[model samples]
Target chain A: MALLQVTDLKTHFFGRRGVTKAVDGISFDLERGEILGIVGESGSGKSVASLSIMRLVDHPGRVVGGSVHFEGRDLLKLGREEMRTLRGRRMSMVFQEPGTSMNPVLKVGFQIAEAIRSHERVSNQEARERTMDLMELVGIPDAKRRIDQYPHQFSGGMLQRLMIAMGLALSPSLIIADEPVTALDVTIQAQILDLLRDLRDTTDAAVLLITHDMGVVAETCDRVIVMYLGKIVEEAPVAELFDHPKHPYTQGLLGSIPKIDEKQEWLAAIPGTIPNPLEVPTGCRFSNRCPQVMDVCHHVSPELQVVGPGHRVACHLYGETGTVDADA
Target chain B: MPDAVMETRHLVKQFPVEGSRDVVHAVSGVDLIVLRGETLGLVGESGCGKTTMGRLVLRLIEPTAGEVLIEGRDLGALSKRELRRVRSELQIIFQNPFASLNPRMSVEEILRRPMEIHLRISAAERSRRVGLLLEQVGLREEHRNRFPHEFSGGQRQRIAIARALAVEPKFLVLDEPTSALDVSVQAQILNLLKRLQRDLGLTYLFISHDLSAVRHMSDRIAVMYLGKVVETSASETLFNDPQHPYTKALVSAIPVTNPRLRRERVRLTGDIPSPIHLPKGCAFHTRCPFVMDRCRTEGPVLQETGGSASHLVESHLVSCHLVDPA
Candidate 1:
């Protein structure tokens, strides 16, 4: 069985205008010890989907449909108290911005120890020890000295390491990291990615990584789910997706990035901007910007079909009898 | 082939830490040039002083020691009144577009302030200019009346660009202009910058931590480590053949989207040294993979390699004593 299965999950924000289908009927599964990357541009609902899984989606947002099953237990149907118990223990989330995620007044040690004290019945001494150990594990130098200092004393990269320490403190089964290294420099990003891979190897926990960078996905993830306008347009393994991306949106996203090796005149971006969630286009959501869009795509929405082993795409071009091997 | 629109000689900026005798060596002993109609990328990690260097070029923040020559005039020698006059020729677009824009003012009012302050244009003429600028940035005339909060992030940045162009500045300091936008929006903004430069003949000093975006946007690139330019070369040459170890590590660390060509990742050990108490020799020698014995004692100066006066690197350009000790 999959470690976590999100089935037809639909998260929407109810506003004065209408319901913004942020995570509209998306379904995917994460296996244990696997890094599943969700790649998309901003407002593509990648962050919202991760937030929905953690049950951390704020007000004006609600999971309108679908079930989230973790270890064969329904996460969406859990009661308030039960869910709270599961949050810091069974699962954890690391937000994108470490500067904002941490409290200004509190010391880094206290904040990290609070996470320990939230789930475990331990003394302050034990909590402090665990926090230091976690800090050291995340590669923070002089963990003992830095533990007493406030979050502001640490640099941006150091602050991100602190967040990782807190997230890994409980030995959770899964971690949802939203743009974990986006704020970091390239070398720092590489270090954090290595740390994440190390954590997964040692802890036996899965990760659902969400980022706008396809380069990151190519480097770290085992599988990738391409999201556009709050929907998954393509899902495939990392190597396969890079080798033979089927969806036009995915292709555009890949082609638009300037590789360090290749010289090009232009990075071909998708012609139009992403449609506002309030004014989502009917039929195929990407039809407006799809370079290979057909007339039939304007009136018909395509369902995700398995075109190869462990590869799926939702496009009209591959209507019923499209069987392209992604690994080719 | 083109004249250097802006050049700095030994640019230095030191900030006094509050309640401390020691000062933060924010930007120390830097030299750079921005060519006419060329986008020069200044890339580094946070606290590496890329932003400070950009500000020094615009003279927004006064440089403690150095000569910032813009179009043949030394900015350091200029008086307050003269600097104000020069300010109209050089402008800056900040990293956070939302924070940079005035929340209380509409887009039209924001655009109008720059023109009113510097250009002395009539009210009727200001309105027309603002409308034309909005249309130029791909925004409709209807958007001028709306507040910044009403527009998307990409639109807000376009407005910021319009405000920067209000004075018809020939030189622009774009500090991470596209870093705040999404990927697709980043492409749009970069394309817009390229197009605007070609059309308006604008020179740019683009500062960013995103190397990939910087590589895409810049004509020449400078890799900055703590408070200094480690390497400077043409964009293609720098990307293809990085001379400095820091530049090589930076380029190597950039995750390529293609999986077929997976390069071995070289993880740079140790964090960036504190700018307050920098290393004895090279600031990056603490973390550099190719550190020599002399690197820990004496500083290296930026020198030309391969008889090419354009490509400058602080470290030994090719094989050093640390590598091939023949």
Candidate 2:
């Protein structure tokens, strides 16, 4: 069985304006020792889906319908106490900004050790040793002296390393990182990304890396899921997805990026901005901006259908004749 | 007018550390020249002083030392009256459109404010020009009544671009103008900027941490590390054949969009040393993989590299003791 299997997940936010469908009927499976990338723009409900799976959504936002099955149990069906225990043990989440996630006053090592102690009854000394080991493993040099330093003392790259270490405190089987290196500088970002890749090789943990950057997704992720307006528009292996993006949204995203290898006078920019969540379009989310948008695309929403081996795309281009591949 | 639209000679900015004897070495000695109708990309990691360099070019902040000349006229030497007059010649577009523009002000008011100060025109003329500016920036004239809050992030950025173009500035300091937007939206904004530059024949100092975006926009690219211009070359050549170790690491670090083309990463393993307390020689020496014994004591000067130099900016320039002089 897959490590984590999410089926028809629906997370909605109740507001004064209206019910905003953040993660609407999204389903995917993550296997052990795999890094699955969720790529999308802001308000595409990528972050909310991860939050839903973690059961960390607050009062206004609730998982209206979903089954996040992890280790033979439905995560959404678990009680408050049971769900709390599952988190930071079976699975853990790493946020975008490292500075905001950590406390300024507390020592960095102490906080990392605290994560371990929270899950298990370990002695302070034992936790401290493990923290130093994790720090060293994550490539933070001179861990002995740096352990006593506060979060403010650490640079952006160091802090992110600490965050990743905290995520691995309990040897969690699954890790969900949201825009992990977005806030970092390119040099530092490369270090962090390389570390994450290294962690995947060293550990059995399945990582769900959520990011807006296509280059990051291509570099790190083994598999890619393109999301738009709370729906999976495309899903494929990195190579196949990049080379043959069936959906217009995915194609637009690929075309929009200014490639470093070659020089082009003008980019194939998708015309309009992402529509507001409150007033979603009747049919396709990307129809407003799609260059090759058809008349039917403006009214009828296409279902995610398998095109090639392990490749799935949702668009009107492959209409009724599209076959659903059970293996995908 | 000179061939170069804007030129900076030995620009330096050192911010005094609060409650400490130390100073943040924000921008060390640097020289740059932005040619007319060309986009000069200033790329670096955060705290590398690309933004500070842009600000210094516009005289937004007083540089500790150096000269900023626009069309052979020194910004520092200008009197208050002369500065006011010269202000119309240069303009800046900041990163965040939401923060840069006033939330309360209407789109028309925001665009017209610059024209009102710079251009000696009637209110009626300014109003008509506001409509023209709105159209020029891909924003509708009907959006004139809308406040900043009502528009989307992309629309707000369009408004910001419109405001900058209102005064008809020859030189534009675009400091991460598209960084705040999404990729699709960012593409739109970038294209808009390129189109505007072409239409107005405006010179641009495109400062951004985003390498890919900078690669798309700039005619020539300069790689900065810890307030120093470590390397400068023609846009395509720099990426294809990066000479400096710092530049190589930076180029290598950039995630390849194509999975098939993943290159071997040259990792820089060390803490990014504090700018406040720089080392004896290079600021990047601690983290530099190719750090030599000489690099520990003596800094390298920015010199021309052994490349086919057709023009001044296109001539590959790198700062490293190892690189053979042209």
Candidate 3:
């Protein structure tokens, strides 16, 4: 069985303007030791989906329907107390900005120890030992002295490593990292990615990596999901998605990026911006900007259907055929 | 070859630390020349002085030493009145459009202010020009009355571009203009900038940490490290045949969009050393893959490589110990 399976998840924000369907009817599964990437532009509900899965969405937003099945249990159905216990113990999260995510005043050692103590009924001394071990495991140099330092004392790269250590402290079965290295420099980003890749190899934990960067998805993810205006538009294996993107939105995103290897005089820029969530188009959300958009696309939403082996796309163009070949 | 519209000669800027004699070497000795109608990309990670260098070229921050020349006229030699007149020809587009633009001002007011100051044009003329500028940047005429908060990030950026173009500047220093926008929106802004450049014959010093965007927009690219220019070459050559070790690592680090074409990343271990207390010789020697004994004591100078004739301005130059000075 897959480690985590999400089905028809719906998360919405009830603002004064209207209901913003942030993560409207999304579904996917993550296997053990697999890294699943969720790619999208801003306001596409990728981040909200992760937050919804973790039950971290605040008051304005609520998880309305659907189930997040992890280890044979439906996460959405769990009670608040039970969900709290499961969070740091079985599933943890890493955020984009490590500096802001961590408590400013708390010592690094105490934060890790606290996460351990909260999840497991361990003595303070035992938790301290575990914290030190985690620090060493995440490759913090001089783990002994550094553990006493506050979050402010550490550099951006080191703080992110500390966050990883905290996430790994309880040996969680799953981790949902939302733009974990986006705030970091390219060189530092490489280090964090390497660390994550190494963690995946060593531990049995599955990672749900969320980012806007297609390059990061190509490098790190086993399978990828392309999100648009709160819905999954495309899903495929990493190699298959990049090589053959059937969904017009996915194709446009792939074309928009300036390739470092190939020098093109002009990039195929997708016209227009992401539509306002309050006034999302009745049919396909991307129809307003999609180049290959048809008249039917403007009025009818397409369902996510299997295109090739382990590949699925949601678009009217593929509705007629039901499935497209991997090469096509 | 086109004459350099703007040039910097060994420009340096250092911020003195509060409680110590040490200084933050923000931008060390650097020489750069931006030719007319060409985009020169300056790329580096945070605190590597790409932004400082861009600001230095515009004389936004007074350089601690060295000179900035615009149309062969030294900016430092210009008096206050002359500098104000020169300012119209040189403008900057900041990273965050939301922050750069005033919250109280509407798009129309923001666009018209530059023309009022620089052009000495009538209000009617300014209004007409603002509408035209808005249209040029792909924004609608109705957007002129809306406040900055009302528009999306991409639209706000378009407004920023419109403001920059309002004065009819010949040179612009775009500092991470699209970094704050979404991917699709980023492409839109890039295309708009390219069109505007072609239409107005604008010379740009494009400053960004995003290597891919830089590769797309730039004719020539310069790699900066610890307030120093490590390499400068044509965009194609720099991306394909990066000579400097730091440049090589930077080029390889860009996550290639295609998984099958993943190249072996030259991973540089350790953080960029604090500029306040820099390493002995080469600032990048601590992280350089090809560090040598000579590199530890002697800093390399920018030396021209083989292909000098083809480029419009300087030859393909790199500062590294490995390159033989033949």
Q: Local distance difference test, per candidate?
A: 0.86, 0.90, 0.90
Report residue A20 deviation for candidate 2 (angstroms).
0.4
| 1 versus 2: better DockQ goes to | 2
Residue by residue across B50-148, what tens digits does model 3's lDDT show?
998888888888999999999999999999999999999998999898898898999999999989889988889999998899899999988989999
* Cα lDDT of model 2 by residue, A1-328, tens digit: 9999999999999999999988888889999999999999998999999999999999799999979999989998899999999999989999999999998899999999999999999999999999999999888889999999999988888889999999998999999999999999888888888888889999978999999999999889999999999989999999999998898899889889999888888988888889899877767667788888887777777788889998998888888433333222
Give one digit per residue, the lDDT tens place, for model 1 in A72-137. Answer: 999999998999999879889987899999999999999999999989999999999999999999
Q: Model 3, stretches more than 4 Å misplaced?
A: A121-126, A320-328, B307-314, B324-326
lDDT of 2 at B241: 95
> What's the DockQ of model 1?
0.61
TM-score of 3: 0.96
True contacts preserved, each candidate? 0.66, 0.84, 0.79
Tell the DockQ for candidate 2: 0.85
TM-score of chain B of 2: 0.97
Model 2 residue pairs with clashes: none
lDDT of 3 at B43: 97
- The residue-by-residue lDDT of candidate 2 on B1-326, one tens digit each, is 23998999999999999999899999999999999999999999888889999989989899999999988889999999999898898999999988999988999889888888889999999999998998999988789999999988899999988998999899999999998999989999999999999988999999998999999999999999889999998898889999999888889999889988877888888666788888878777888888888889988888887756777866989899888452
State the displacement of the C-alpha of residue B209, model 1, in Å, after optimal TM-score superposition: 1.0
lDDT of 3 at B85: 96
Q: What is the C-alpha lDDT profile of model 1 across B78-182, one tens digit per residue?
A: 898998989999989888987999899999999999898898778999999999999878889998889999888888899999998989999999999988877
Is 2 or 3 the stronger prediction by TM-score?
2
